[model samples]
Target: MFVMGHNQLPPHLKKFRRLVYISPVITILSLSLLVWTYSSDMTFQFITRYYHATSDPQTPVQFTLPLHRGPGQMGPEEQKLSLMAVNGTKTVLVAAYQEHRTGQKEVRIIAVVLRSETVAYRCLLRCQEQLRISEGVSTTHSDHFGFAYGTADIMCPLPLGCETASHVTVISAASDSNDTQIQEFLEVKNQKVQSDSFPYNFVVCLSTMFDFTNVLQLVQSLEMLQLLGVNRVVIYKTSNSPETQRILDYYIYKGFVEVIPWSLSKFVNVSRGWLPEHGPGDLHYLGQIPALNDCLYRYMYQSRYVALQDMDELILPQSVNSWLELVPLLEMKYGEDKCYMFENNVFPNTVSLPPPTSQTLPPPSCCPGWENVSGVNILAHLYQEPIITETHYTNFKIIVNPRAVFSTSVHGLLSSLIDCSWVDRNIARMYHTRASRQTELTEDELIYDGRLLSYSTKLIPNVNAVFRESGLLPEGSIQ
Candidate 1:
């Protein structure tokens, strides 16, 4: 070995050479190690948004390490911990860290749950190495599985069904408390949805058909819809039938229904496609039938569900007595994004008449039992001077998701996006009282009537000419 004294060393360069080579290597090595450790152990999280399908409420995201004890082997002095969420589904990602009881060296493990698109439920745990020194011999230890437990439970949407599994892709990390990589597990690539549509709890639009003329039955049906938790009702009257007007007014007075005047004839001019034109004498059908479509178009834009029908038709109850009871069952069985379809059954003679046209009235205590009497009650009662028979009865009705309804017609139309199911038959019916006292009309009344003017106009073009020539609107009221 050769030894040199400080005096023999090169005074100008020795110190600089030593400093440049050693210090730079040390600094570079320390930085490289720090970068590797940070890249390995650092984790991230993000905040996301969700919406309620049926209601307008939005849930807030709360983050914290849960207080539950983790499952697995643990040291006598060490306490294990895990995380959980409540109210809504939660996503959790965990990283492990260890510290020596002596020198206090630190080690960390980074983890990520790879699956989380819009909504998800899952947990991730990362294993970390622990270091311990005994008798001057250094020993390193690593856990096979991270020292944590507890899992995420994901909440799925309505009409949920199993599908083919796809690989979970981890996305960019969110720098929050979740400490997991956010990813999209489910994707709707080309979902086509209608825009600018009205959403309502339920919508029922009434169209008057000159059948049975049961004003009382109409009021009861309106009340029943209100009791069923329907928030709004639109009565589309084509004919200015005094009795029908009275029934609508009764509901309006009670703050239950809204009456909007519409003529079927003007509808024909404004609506061209899917509407068939009527000729001279057949104009009655235009006012009575096509009025459904016209009124629905005006009112259904803001409703979530819609039912269109004549005054005689009513939605009866089967599984549940009222709509209030049925909504929850529906939410549980079909989820928030579902539609219900009701089949038509005719219940004749549920109405009792010479009924007043307008007024608020209660539906019968029980569904009418047409056990024995038949032969069209309206005709039987009106034919006799005493009017012995009753005419108050329910006919038929259809239930549907208003949002899923596409076109309005006499029968109506529902879109295919909805999951359709049948309602119990005994609960509701469509009573056809057309063959009774309603079939007859005086030529003058048909020609000069203002009551049926709107329906006549929508269904019958130039109906104003007939009414005007007949001296109905007098020239002053005519446009």
Candidate 2:
């Protein structure tokens, strides 16, 4: 009866039955279209929530809230600030800011990408118009030391030259449609939005410290840096021992060490050495150059000078007591707008000065309980490898006016208008304490340098105090 009803039904009833059958299919199609529409609007909605309405011909930023991304659409801005790959390309974006240098007049994203292009990218600015300008998206790659994974400045020039942007998002335009995928906007930094005096005089950058367990030396180094007039120490550390973490946390509480997360190996196949022969990886020195460059720009306007050095070394003033006394002399001798290169005078661990006979004599090198700490004591090693005539003035580390330098490298400037000069070793030299580079040299052949001993009177107690603060050494350890 039910099967026969459709053919035997009255004319009016038959039409109504057919309408009911087709309506459910129509409803399903409508819901699918609604979901697609909402998905496309997520980025636009995420943006419009923060930026206020503006119709100015200049079309600068109207306003900006705390820079955050929409949920479930993409991954969270991870707790670790590692390199972010741009939409599945080799191009990994580290940061972005308005370009005031080189007069390029664009927004430059500091990134890790192939030296040559594999894909096209563009700027998706959070402007009044919600602008998408893909025409001027060019690539400026800094192939520092001919390393395989060079740092690229993915350039996005503004059409109306708006430098007042509070933030901007970058996207890959190589897709079938430019609007398919989007990356979160990094709040524009180094903006120079307002002119003011720098907060610090000297800032040091120690990059790519991996698996560090040098606790005693790290404490001694920071104490020495403080004595030498460094206002800030930026450490881009990959990982460290649990003991070392206590020291870093203490220093951070003391407002000295800034530990930037550096997990480049997690993102790229980072090479262990600087040369090409050290391959089976993508970047050099476990991504050292990018970390250095990031530090430079990060502190470009915050500090008057930035010194790039390793954790195990310090650039000490030979004649003067501290860098406050030394830098003025350097400026007077070399003139301003100069990249001051100090010769790396290696203080070999293999050669040590004779121990003091008295607690107060031969310099105050006695510090109790630090002996139990799991790291080298930088003070004990005083003798240095004799400077080689062939390599004289060749092996160097730099302290430069961050604004004067255009591109920075491991040893020195890759490109800069600033001239390079060697400070006389008597004036200042890098006290590099590490495994001996000249393994052939005997004890007598090395020079006896006691410059570090000069700081021992202060360094001894300072080391003990840090141990106390970090809970690294037990009580009754401080004298």
User: Could you give the C-alpha RMSD of every candidate to the true structure, in order shown?
Assistant: 31.0, 18.4
Write down the TM-score for model 1: 0.35
Which stretches in model 1 have alpha-carbon errors above 4 Å? 1-200, 208-213, 266-284, 287-291, 294-301, 331-337, 350-396, 412-416, 426-479
lDDT of every predicted structure (CA atoms):
0.36, 0.73
The residue-level lDDT of candidate 2 at 112 comes to 78
Task: Compute the lDDT for candidate 1.
Answer: 0.36
182-276: candidate 1 lDDT, tens digit per residue: 43222211122233555556677766433224543454445445555776676643344443443444445334566554333332222221222
Tens digit per residue, CA lDDT, model 2, 1-479: 01232367688867876778777456656766665566535745544554434344333322122222332111112124536666746777787667686665677677777665567776766555365454425444455456667776677776675645566656676644545344566666777832347898889999687888988888899999999989999987777777777677667655688878787777778877777686667787888887888888788888888999998889989989998899888999998746899999888765557744443347444777877888788878887888888667665888888887666778887767788888888899999988998888888788777788888888887777677656677767756
lDDT for model 2, on a 0 to 1 scale?
Answer: 0.73
- Model 2 Cα RMSD, 1 decimal: 18.4
Residue runs of model 2 more than 4 Å from their true location after superposition: 1-82, 134-147, 178-181, 193-196, 355-365
